[model samples]
Target: MSRPRPGAGAALLFDMDGLLLDTERPVFEVFVEEARALGLEDAESFGLSMVGLSSSICQRLLRDYLPAEIGLERFRERWDAGVRARLAGGIPLKPGVAEVLERLTGAGWSMVVVTSTRTVTARSHLGEAGLLDHFLDVVGGDAVPANKPDPAPYLIGAERAGAHSRDCLAFEDSDAGVASALAAGCEVHQIPDIRPPDRPVPQRGQAVHRTLTDAVAAAGLLV
Candidate 1:
């Protein structure tokens, strides 16, 4: 994908879990483990379907999938606990995250995180990953009326960065995230992680790359 030169002061919006932090696989493992502990036979499939979704939506889906006796709250408690235990040490950063952030910072681009994770949790994870300082703000799942694939989160993220959505460039690692950014009118580049982009090919000039490094490099940001 060729780079399009964004106007001066154009913002950079990012997705957190799989895009910036390598937390998706570990978290999905915890989800599968918790589900199987409850004797759910299709745990892996269900867990995969929840990728890039908001907590509320995931909870609602869990409610439908789990036996009434198990209860969503009880399942969430166990699943969240497992996630915490699994990530207790620290979240890992994806390759070239720090370098890209540093390069973008030097280039004077404003940056914001637009993630499906809750505000507090996203903040904490970014801090743990040593990436909190690079962003001007975070727009979490709970902060917007709707999550990814709806465009509200990215719209809010661009607003927080004090730029119009059309002026922002978004980096994402999921189909839902790419859709959100594209719908919000941002130039999007995706680096798929954990799961491939199952949705139809991106429209509006969006491109998918193998890694965050390749995405940014193609955008001419990593001179």
Candidate 2:
């Protein structure tokens, strides 16, 4: 596909959720509600940990919390409901998303969204944010075998975006998302949202920024 003359960036990639929109707050709020309903708020978030992890993995990670009285089936139902509620409420795009996306796309940066949520939900946020058309393709959370920290999502997204991994830039938040992008050979820019650093994320090879605009600027998406 013919694209504009890429100014400074070769290609621009982004992760959904915390990277694209302020999704975690609503998600966590729903989780809290579910936990309150199930009486496992603290334990559930501990298991549901990061944004880019698969629900299956998340469910298994919290298996320890499943009492013999509370089976996995019920846990799954309630958790899915909570997630559905969060999605139903919709989410907001992070500040500077539209400016940076427009800037990068105009500069011929072939941008794609590689996310860990289902395509429907990913599309919802992008559409809601008016950023859906910015991406050439989207790799959803359910599209890959393993989610972030595994490299599949990023690799697949790179392939779909017609970008070589080495020639692409990944914008992400969360440790898992950073690791996945780095592992896929993209230079990663990590914007950690409001997540406090309790443990080191994969920042050794990453450009760390506080916001999408800063990361996009640092990645050469803006002049």
Candidate 3:
């Protein structure tokens, strides 16, 4: 893929869970506990499998590991209840999140959050983290027919930002997200979550960074 033009109207797109917010850890911990309660000993690995998936996709993926006695809907209800309880107080922002947002904001770049979370839930979590006001708009999983790894969400995100996909820099923490952004023609900077992808995601406009700060710098939007 070609580089974005210097004078183009550039936008900064971000993933929510493991990328900008630290909710994945607490959520996955709850998932493991729930899985173990259902007599699944290898719950940790099962929880890890859900890392970057949307709720819909996750339900499908989780069905393989869940017993028939514990159906997908019931499992989701239990996981939701547990995660909500654990995050009743507030969600933590990932390291360098505030600084990176501030830097990009000060530099006058348009910003949008393109996440695999549901619209209502994603908005609530962003509000709780005190980061909702930074984004010009949010494109959640429910907002698009197809989610990450399908590119529909990111494609819609660019449209929402009123910019071409190639004019955006998407910050992600999962291979699925990287693939989504790349497929949408956005330059993607991946900062892996707990477990990084074993192999490179084969796509255009893709790069990996150790941290959010590095991603911002690489995008040339550092203030």
Candidate 4:
């Protein structure tokens, strides 16, 4: 695809979980399993609702659904154990992630990870997936004052890349992520994973595509 050159010094902002790493489904499955084990009703539905949210926010939300006697701490311990076991080998990369990253890297665009996962966990997962070297920095949920659906994470990501948000192109896979990127003044392309977007994604300077390769092609980043 032939297109206008990207702005000089433009950077790429990426959401790590569903967008770059195929970790959402397995992790969420663990959440549902743990919730079910604790006898929570509508476990799958509740777990899906937590997608794209920060761990802190999800824990808060879980408080309302979990029985008072069960305790959030207990549920969290089991859930965390399940997730670790499921990911003990390594996290898998999303479809087209390698190609998209390679293309963008070859184009000389700096990249930063903007994720709701905690900084240490995000770094570890990316390192295990062999994707850590592709990004210049990671702006994790714990690193920001607020997480997704808020602009702080993406704004921090842009700042870390030493570029203005407006000059950055963000790739996400969830509505909350898309909203965060857009609110941070970056152009966004969402590639939905476990769940399709329930809210209306803005059309101007934002788009939804089926895969990372398709999104990159639409952005004229694939030639």
lDDT of 2 by residue, 1-223 (tens): 2222364335677888877788766666665676577676464346347466766666676576656687888766876777767666656778887788887777667788998788887887788778999888888878887788898888888888876777788888878888889899988889886554565554468989878888766655456
lDDT of 3 by residue, 42-100 (tens): 78777776777898888787888788787888888998899889888779888999887
Task: Tell me the TM-score of each prediction against the true structure.
Answer: 0.91, 0.84, 0.89, 0.92
How many clashes does the backbone of model 1 have? 0
**Pairs of residues clashing in candidate 4:** none
* Alpha-carbon runs more than 4 Å astray in model 2: 1-9, 44-48, 71-73, 76-89, 197-202
Q: Candidate 1's residue-wise lDDT over 1-223, tens digit each?
A: 4443434657889999989999998889998888888778888778878889998888888888999899788878888888888888779889888888887877777889999999999999999888899889989999999988899999999999989998888999878888899999998998888863564544556888988889888777646
Error of 1 at 87 (Å): 1.0
Which ten residues in a row are the worst by lDDT in model 2?
Answer: 1-10
Ranking by lDDT: 4, 1, 3, 2
lDDT value for candidate 1? Answer: 0.86
How many Å off is the CA of 85 in candidate 1?
1.2
Candidate closer to the true structure by TM-score (higher is better), 1 or 4: 4
Q: So what's the TM-score on candidate 4?
A: 0.92
Name the 10 consecutive residues with the lowest summed lDDT in model 3: 1-10
On the 0 to 100 scale, the lDDT of residue 210 in model 3 is 85
Model 2 TM-score is 0.84
Q: How close to the true structure is residue 195 of candidate 2, measured as C-alpha lDDT?
A: 55
Candidate 1 similarity to native, TM-score: 0.91
Kindly report which residue stretches of model 1 are placed more than 4 angstroms away from their true locations once superposed.
1-7, 196-205
